[model samples]
Target: MSDFSATGYQPVSVSDPEVAALVGQDLPEDAFREIRDILFTVKGFDLDSYKDRCIKRRIAARIRQLGFPHISGYVACLAAEPTEQLALLEALTIHVSQFFRNPTTFMVLEKKILPALLRTRPAGRELRLWSAGCAMGEEPYSLALLCDELCNSPEQITIYATDISNDILKKARQGRYEPHRVAEVPDSVLKRYFTLEEGFYRLNDRLRKRVRFFHNDILNDRPFHRVDLILCRNMLIYFSPPQQEHILKTFAAALVAGGYLVLGRSETMISETRELFECVNAAERIYRKKADDVKEDD
Candidate 1:
């Protein structure tokens, strides 16, 4: 029902009643499930964990991009071309993200959460952070700059940034952004952390080296444990309810006592995950892991 034009490439829509009828009437919902399941089983990527409405929109985008008439045509293309699987994965996970995407949330994190974590940890100790679904490296890079100011050395603060799409991860690793991408960053901070080119900005090696990028599927992969903070902002809204609950539990397992977890301002903890964390700044969607709970892997 949904389509994928938002990826920046407008696909030419195709109309074929025969193909539409086949994809709709003959294959039915079972066909969709099979295609989704095979993506994980054969290719080791799980697309089915996402909400169906989101899945359908992405599939529609792929269909249009490849000039397929309907699901049947798209399925045929996938069956023939292995590379299409990667394309489909990118389409599904593609989201709009930017540096300091939400200023108030980052402000809350800087003013409240970071200070509390620093005070609790022992002096001269290393700090760990995870940036889930760290699209194009902006979120983790933003965190790295903040940590650089607080910690003794850039090496002391390790930011593990993970995303499901390798294509996006590659872009993130490059640490290069067009002018529009850096528009929100203050000019002074920009001069300190990034080198501005004719039209693109390149994040300095000091900031980039601190963030270790990984091609991780958060839905199925094990998250890094014993992290002092996990920034999973804006990613959960795309997943279904059960998936969200599972991720929150995994985040809980990964955090140390009194660790902080940050989400998008629009996102909040589900009723099921409320016990694991207490809201530190509800207005900014920041939560701290309960000090008393034992760490258990999900």
Candidate 2:
């Protein structure tokens, strides 16, 4: 998941000395475990899967803001107040995304990947794509726009977008975005596909209808099957190595043989999963699932 900031809360840096000091204080291990259990019981969020330093630092920042001197106090607050739990979950999991987030990655997809995949597709078959961790619908809508332009018929493509937060999924289904969220979008595309409403740019029904938004937790939920492409960007960095491998293996299983996987610019395929996929473009962090006929490395 990408970094999230609630209203009135400044973003916390993991390396900040203040956060370090807070975490370094009399925070007992059991208290931390209690906090994790409370979060799981209330929100179903597996805090243990996240990198300890990052999650702890974010919690520490919240603790600092709420004027709690220790982790125990915050644990009590979380157990007593459901609203605080949701606010913390939002702070932890919410991501702000834009249309065509990384131009270069989309350029690679448009110029190279899409053309190649379409050429190899059998006639009468639809191209399937999944945007995992799609926040606010921008990522999937961006894919829909690209597929719409490339394919001869809109029905020739299917786009599935999922997020863990039901509240975010509801917003994503609306297919509405602020102007800044669409700043990267070309003016021509903006005019053709979206309507300028009172203030927000509302996606036209054509593109809006193209995407299917759902609530999915990649960790515990079953993945979509036989997908042609999967875009899960900037999400793995927050997880521990084992959790990262688990998610990557899930992605690998979901993709068809020779299907593509595109990750965030900063993410890389972990060593444990390197045998499952072959790197296609290192610069853009694109990879292709190895065909079944290929043998794994010793």
Strongest candidate by TM-score: 1
TM-score of 2: 0.79
In candidate 1, the residue pairs with backbone N, CA or C atoms under 3 Å apart (3 or more residues apart, or in different chains) clash, namely none
- Of candidate 1, the 10-residue stretch with the lowest lDDT total is 5-14
TM-scores, each model vs. reference: 0.82, 0.79
Residues 1-298 of candidate 2 have per-residue lDDT tens digits of 3233442435455475544567564334566688779887766577886644566667666776666544555788899999888778877774779999988999999889988888998888888899999989999999888988887887778899988788888888888889999999999999999998889999999898899988888878888887889999977765667778889999888888899999998789997689989999999999999998333221
Badly placed stretches (over 4 Å) of model 1 are 1-58, 67-70, 76-82, 296-298
lDDT of 1 by residue, 1-298 (tens): 4454553433433255535544443434665676777676556555654544556645665565565555665677776667887777777776568888888777776776776777777877778899998999899988887777776665767899999888888999999998877778889999898987777899998788889999888878888978999999888877667778888888998998888899887688996799989987888888889976746442
TM-score of 1: 0.82
* CA RMSD per model (angstroms): 5.6, 7.1
User: What is the alpha-carbon lDDT for the whole of candidate 1?
Assistant: 0.78
Candidate 2, run of 10 with poorest lDDT: 1-10
